[model samples]
Target: MFTRTLLCVSLSAAAMPLMADTVWMKNGDRLTGTIRLLDGGKLLLETDYGGSIPLSWSKIATLQSDHELLVKENQITGERAKSLLASDEGKVTLANGDTPKTVELASIKQIMKPKPFVEDFLWKGNVDVAMDYKRAESDTDDYDVDLKTQARHGKWRHNATVDYNRELRNDVVSTDNWGTEYALDRFLDEQWFWQGRLEYKRDKIEDLARERTVGTGPGYQFWDNELGALSVAGLLNRTDYEYADGEKDNFYAISMRWDYNRYLVGKTFELFSTGEVGKPLASVADYSLDAEIGLRYKVTDWASLNMKASKDQVSGSDGDKDETRYTVGFGVGW
Candidate 1:
C-alpha cells in the first residue's frame, strides 16, 4: 500500500505543466508566468498568483519564451518573422533553424501570437462612470459616463468611444452632452498610417444641437512605447452643424488633431491631453477649437479616479459661444 501511494503521487507530480515563460529582473528577481504578449516595450505576463503583470522591457534583464512568437522588427514596414525568443543582456537570440539571428532587444517593435491563431486577435477596453450627488436646501447632481475600446487583427486596428453626461443645479438642468466617435487605422509603415474618422455630438446647453463630421487624413505616430504616445494628424472634414434655434450650416474645413498620453508611477497614474483646431478653407476666421486635459489615478487593478476639464469654442456664434466644464468621478473596468 505504501508503494502504490508513492507511485501515484509521483505520477501526478510529473503530469503537471510548468509555466512556459521566465523573466529575470535587473534587480535579481525572477518570475515565471505565461507570456500574453510583448507590445510597445511592455510585456503582459499572467501569473497564477498575481493575476496579470505589465512588465516593461526596461525592468527585464533576461527572459525565455518556450513557444514561438511573431516578431515585428521595430518598423511596421518590415515583415514579421516567427522565432522562439531568448533575451539576455540587451539582446534577443532568435531560433529559426537556418541561422541564429541575434538582435538588440530594444529593436523589436512588437511580439505576439505565440499560438499562431489565438492571441493575434484580441479586444481590450475600459468603461468609466463618475457622478456626484448633493442634497441641501436644493438638490444638485452631476455625472459622466465614458466607454472606450481598441481591437487588433493582423495589420488592422479599430477604436471606438462613447460618452454621456448630465448636470443639474437647484432643480434646473445646466448641461447635457453626449457623443460617439469611431476611428479606423490601416498601417502602411512603422510611422505612417491612413485613417478615417467619424464623430457625432449633440449638446443641449451649448445650443449646438447637432454635429456630424467625416474626415480622412494621414497620421504620424511620433512615439509609441512603454512610456506613452504622441500622434498628430491633418484631416479635411465635411462638417454639418445645427443650432438649438433651428439654424443650420455646413462647411468644409482643414483640421489638425493632436493626442498625447503618458503613464507614470509604474502605470498607476496617467495624464492625457487632446486638442483639435479647424480652419474653414472658405472662411478662415470662422475657425474653431476644442481641447481636453485629464488625469487618472488608478486605485486598483480595475478601478480608477479621474478628473477632467474641457473647453469648446466656436467662431461667429452669437453671445459667448465658449463653454467649459470640470468634472470628477470614479470608474470600474476590466
Candidate 2:
C-alpha cells in the first residue's frame, strides 16, 4: 500500500505541467504557468511557485497555452483563438476547431485573455489616502482622500473621481474641501472620442464656497495598453461660482485637459500626471489651473507606496489664490 501511494503522488506531480501553459526559452529553460498577457515586450506568467514572472518576449523560443486568448498581430485587429500550439522557434499556431493558423512570434503585438461574453466590460481604479501630522509650537494635522475609477465597454467609457481634504491647527479647522467629477466618453473610432463632464467643488472655510462646471468636447487617445495610456481633450465649459459672502458669478471658458501614465521595470513603478488649465472668457477669473503629478511603487500586485505634488491656482479671483501640497501615501489599484 505504501508503494502504490508514493507512485500515485509522484505521477500527479509530474502531470501538473501538462495541464498549464508552457514556454520554452532560448536558453533551454522550461517554465509552466498561466499566461496572463503579453504587452510592452513582456509576457506575464502567473506561476504557483513564483507568483507572476515577466519574461522578455524576444527570448522565447516557443510557447503553448491550454486556454483561449485574443491575439493581435502587427498592430492590427485581434482574433480569438481556441488555444495556442507551439511550432518551430519564433512561431506559434492559433488553434481553432479545424483550422490552425501559424504565424511568426515576432509579428504578434499583444495577447490577452478574453473577457466573458456576458461581462464584456473592463474595470480599473485606485484609492489613495494621505495624512500629515506635526507637533511643534502649534500642532497641525492634515488628511486627504482621493478616489478614481473607470470602466470601458466597447465604444463607451465612464470615469469618476472624488477628493476630500482637511487640515487642523491648534484644534481649529484651517482647510476643509471636497470635490467630485464624472465624465463619459463615446469613441468614434480607435483614437477619437467625444466627452461630456460635470464637476462640483465645495469649501467650508474659504470665500469660494461653491463651484460648478459642465463641459463637453472632443478628445484623442494616443495609446492605451498594459504599459500605460495618454489622452488629451479640448472643452468648452460653463462654470458657476458662489462665494461665502453671497456673491455669485458665471463664466464661459475654453480649456484643455490631459491625463498620462507610464509603467517601468516590469510594472514595478508608475509615473503619472493629470490636470486641466482653462482661461475663462469672462472676468470672474483670468486663468485657473489644478494639477497633480505622482509616482507609485508597487509593493505587491494590488498595494503601492505613492508620493504626489499638487497645485491649485487662480490668477484673478476675488483674491488671488495659489496653493501647493506634497503628500506621501499608500494606495490600492486594480
Candidate 3:
C-alpha cells in the first residue's frame, strides 16, 4: 500500500504543465518571452508570438518565474537539484538557482503602455472687448469700443481688429469714425514666418483712407496657441490714401508688430514709418510716422477685450499736423 501511494503522487507531479515566463525591464517596461540567452549580461529572447528580441541586461529591472518545479534527490551524489520548469502545484528553481516559492502569473500587473512616436496636436483662438476714452489738452472727450480677434491653425495664423468711436471734437468732420484691419501670416518653418495686411478707415466727413500692404519678411514666434501666435514681422508696405477731394497719395512704409493671443491676456507693440517717396496718384504725396501700443485680456475661450493707443505725425500739406487716438473694444472668435 505504501509503494502504491508514492507511485500515484509521482505520476501526478510529472503530468502537470508549466506556466508562462514574464520579463520585466528596469525602465518600468515589461514583456512576456522565453529567454534564449543570458550571456555577456544581455538576453536574447523568443516572444510567445515567435519573434526574436534582444534585451540589454543593464535595462532589466527584475525577472521572475511563473511556476515552480521539483527535482528528485540523487542518492549516489548525495545532492538534490530543482527543476526550472514551472507547475501549478509544485515548487520550481529560479535563474538565481534559488528554490521556488509561490509564484503566480495571473497576479502580475501590467505597468504602462508603449510610448507613442508623436504627442498631441494643439489648437487655439481668442476675442477681446473694452472701452476707450480720450481727450486732447484742448478738445472734447472722445470715446470708443474696440474689438479684436486672433486665430491660428497648425503653422498658419490670422488677426483682425476694428474700432467705432464718437469724433466728439474735430471740426471739418462729422462726429463718427470707424476703422478696421486684417492680417494673415504663414509660418515658413519652426522659427520664421511671412505676413500681409490691409487696413481701411472712414469718417462721417466723406473722407477715406485705404491701404493695401503686402510684404514677405522673417518672423520670430515668441509664443503661440491653436488660434494664433505672438510674433514680430518685419514688413515693407505699399499704401494708398484717398481724400474727399478725389485726391490720392501712395507711399512705402517699413513696419514691425508684436502680436498677442486672442484670449486678451497679452500685449502688442508696433512701429511704422513711411519712406519719403510718393506714388504719382492724383498728384498727392505724404510721409508719416506712426507707433502703437496695446494690451489684451481674454474673457473666455471665445471672447476677449483690448485697448490700444496710437500716435501719428504727418509732414505733408493738407494733412493733420499731428494726430493721436486711444481705443478699446471687445470681439469674438470661433
Give the whole-model CA lDDT for all candidates, comma-separated: 0.73, 0.87, 0.48
TM-score of each: 0.70, 0.77, 0.45
Which candidate would rank higher by TM-score, 1 or 2?
Answer: 2
Candidate 2 lDDT by residue in tens digits, 236-268 = 999998989998989999999998998765677
Candidates ranked, most accurate by TM-score first:
2, 1, 3
Using TM-score as the measure, name the better of candidate 1 and candidate 3.
Answer: 1
- Model 3, residue 104: distance off in Å is 41
Q: What does candidate 1's lDDT look like per residue over 1-334, in tens digits?
A: 4335334533553487634676666676768777666665677777887876878887776565656666678545433344444444566667677776778777776666433221278576677777889999979898888887877676566878888889899879988889898988776776678889999988888766878889989999886544556888899999888888888777889999887887665556778887789987765237788888898887876788988898878876432357787888886656
Candidate 3 stretches greater than 4 Å from native: 1-143, 169-175, 205-216, 225-230, 260-290, 295-308, 327-334
Ranking by lDDT: 2, 1, 3
- The model with the greater lDDT, 1 or 3, is 1
Please give the lDDT score at residue 147 for candidate 1.
84
Clash pairs of candidate 1? none
Candidate number with greatest lDDT: 2
* Number of clashing residue pairs, candidate 3: 29
